[model samples]
Target: MVVYQSNSTNKRSRGFRVRSLSHFAERRVQSQKLPSHEDTYPEPGKSKVTEEKPRETRDEWVISIKDKVNKARGDVTASTWDKLCIYRVPHYLQEDDKKSYFPQTVSLGPYHHGKEHLLPMECHKWRAVNMVLEHTKKGIETYVDAMKNLEETARACYQGPICMSSNEFTEVLFLDGCFVLELFRGTKEGFTEIGYAPNDPVFAMGGLMHSIQRDMVMLENQLPLFVLDKLLELQPDTVYQPGLVAQLAVKFFAQLMPTGEELTKMDKVESVDLVGDNGELHCLDVFHRSLFKSTRTPDGKSLKKSMSSRKQQLIHCVTELKGAGVKFRRKKTDKLWDIEFKKGYLKIPKLLIHDSTKSLFSNLIAFEQCHANSSNDITSYVIFMDNLINSAEDVSYLHHCGIIEHWLGSDFEVADLFNRLCKEVVFDPRDSYLSKLSGEVNRYYSRKWNSLKATLRHKYFNNPWAYFSFSAALVLLILTLVQSFFAVYAYYKPSS
Candidate 1:
């Protein structure tokens, strides 16, 4: 019985091994007969999958990559929203002078938003927002909702991506927008009424107010004009007064204006009606427009002439001009950019330079450089000043002429300020109104006789004593020449 069982087991094992080999052979045959993935899944419209293309050569690969890059760039540009019209301070300008381009007292936009140094102002911002909410009797949610509508548009106003989430960005817009509106109102109304301590450093204090003003006008420290407009529209005051925001803003920045007299004249003539509609980009833009409006005469033809007459040119510095007998005098105009040259006299309007002056000019010049179709008037003025003030003596000369009224300690500081202000500044000197003025000044300077006359006067007639001595010497020389002539005549007369 055992022998029969062992023989049956061996037969079963042999049968199982035979079945496995047959199954494997059948699978191999089936796989060989079946189609490949390419053949099975041919392109829908084609009969067969196309053959794989050959690998590209190195040069071909480079060209293909370049084309893809260019195409991607074009797509990105096309898909991008309208250019923000905001820009970072050029790196070249910031390398040597970072403070002028950066905000110091407060942060307004996302770029410097929540910085450690600027955190102190966050409390003030919140307080300002709260004051606005309380005054308007509107909840913060209203502002948040309104800004939410403007979120995408406001984001596009900045030059680059804002790293915050949409909700965070909207909240920032609400807080900062309210804060700015409330701050501007505070200046109009008292800071104490706007929920600030009487001694609040940023808004109420004396010295710090100037710094905050300087910071608020920085390119990096600007808010979207639409955000400000939205907030302004929601104000109850706008119902009673159409341009309450513009009036408040104009009043707030009145003291800091470059040309206060002109602004006042403009207020009388135009009534601040051009504030929101005149293509102002932000607070600085509003301020800039006020200047433009103020400086122009009522006829508007003067502005046309000023704009058309810009011819970029370079002129001599103060020292060289002095040597060429070019006189420096203060032109009694409220406009800072109005400089004139006539009859060997260079008339620069009185410039009040304070600690904030450098920061102000730097940002204004930077704004001009960053924007398209922007006039380089401010930049050209800065460049012209920089060229004219080469040393402390130049600053002294301007100061003595009443052209420069600086709060700095020394003339050297003022000189250094102007000399360094336009360093790395982007400007087309030939495209500025200053160019025409400079051309005239340089033409006057180039007359060789003017320089010669200056030299002779300086050498022979600079002082009363020098004049007296020169006159005496001339008289003595004439007498000596006459005596010598008489002696020569007597000798040559042959005893006649």
Candidate 2:
């Protein structure tokens, strides 16, 4: 400044400084409006954007609207909404237009109460397919009444010791709610004949009877035996008199039948009696006596003591029979007599002869003859045999058969008889049987699954491909964790 610079140079220097300051101020304002490059972008040499993309305003609005619409639709479909509409629809709408516009007034109609109403009458020709599937899945309970009636009709047309093959018998006889009785005729050659009563026709006629009883409690008024016979044509076996059989049948229908608890309680007040010609009483006393005697005594003294005494007497008799080498047949039968050396087999024959009622006097006479013919002292043999035959009636052939079958293979026939009887006689369902309730619960779940499938079919049948894709995506998501687990394991696994 002391040397005094040129005027032109000073003016130029001042101009340059002003321009530089203005440029700096403009840049500062621009930076305030738009962030600094470093703040908005990645570091140099890296990508310009981060992983997350900025959402669009249009998409946000659309999503918001969709969410609101879905929420409103859910409200409209709720049970509470239906209930409210039911009570308040008249107040909400004009009377003339209410029936057409209101939700409650819309005619959804009553639910179909029967399968027949579910499908058209013309469509019934194809119902066999549904019937077969339903039968297989739910079991034969529904069609049993119809089948029983058909069987009864078939039985009425047949006569003369009518016999059905085992398979046929199984179809007709083993159905639920049916009562069957199997009788075997024993001949000299073993059991040779079998019979069953109230064959197919009886079951058919009894259908209406069961239906009446099932539907109307008051309709269970007893019917006359003659009328029942005319309808059922039931023939009681010689062993089972009509009066006794009918009494048991009535007792079974009233008290012992497996029905709902309410029905059972109702039946309790009803008396079950059967009137028969000749005033002969068909008694259940014998059956009761047999059952009581077969039961083991609580004290255990009686049976053991009796068995011990019988064993000694049995051994002596078997020895005498063997020594004599008597070649004889069962008195009233043609079957050859057997004398077994084994104690168990030897004991069985003695037990059978002891309990038997046929030819009691003849058996005693034969024993006396055998003793006189033997070289051993005859007096002891005669007295022993006499007492054995007298008390033998108390010995239970069936009970002995049970014990024998447990220990030996000779009681197959006896076991078969018991099995048949058990199949015929139905019992009240017990807790043990009701353990299958869980299976029934599973069945209900299956029905729910079917209903869900039907609903899905109705709702999305037009968009099967889209539905399938959605389903596949959902499934893939569900299984993602599993795939990830395997992938992680593979990544960490050591090379073999």
Instruction: Please tell me which predicted candidate would have the highest lDDT against the true structure.
Output: 1
lDDT (0-100) at residue 454 of candidate 2? 47
**Segments in model 2 whose C-alpha atoms lie over 4 Å from true places:** 1-177, 181-241, 244-319, 325-327, 333-496
Please provide, for model 2 over 68-89, each residue's C-alpha lDDT reduced to its tens digit, 9 standing for 90 to 100. 9999897556423111100111
- The C-alpha lDDT values of all candidates are 0.74, 0.29
How far is 200's C-alpha from truth in model 2 (Å)?
13
Report the Cα lDDT for candidate 2. Answer: 0.29
lDDT tens per residue, model 1, 1-496: 9999999999999999999999998899798887768788877787964587778888998999999999989868754445465678888777888998898788887889878998988988887777787788887778888999988777777777789999988888888888778767778777787667887776673747777778878888888776787887887755634455556666766666654234445452354666544323677666665555442333332322122324333676899999999989988877666677888889887777777787888787777767664556676677788889889999999889988888789999988887787766655666556676788888888999999999988777788999888889999999999999999999889684
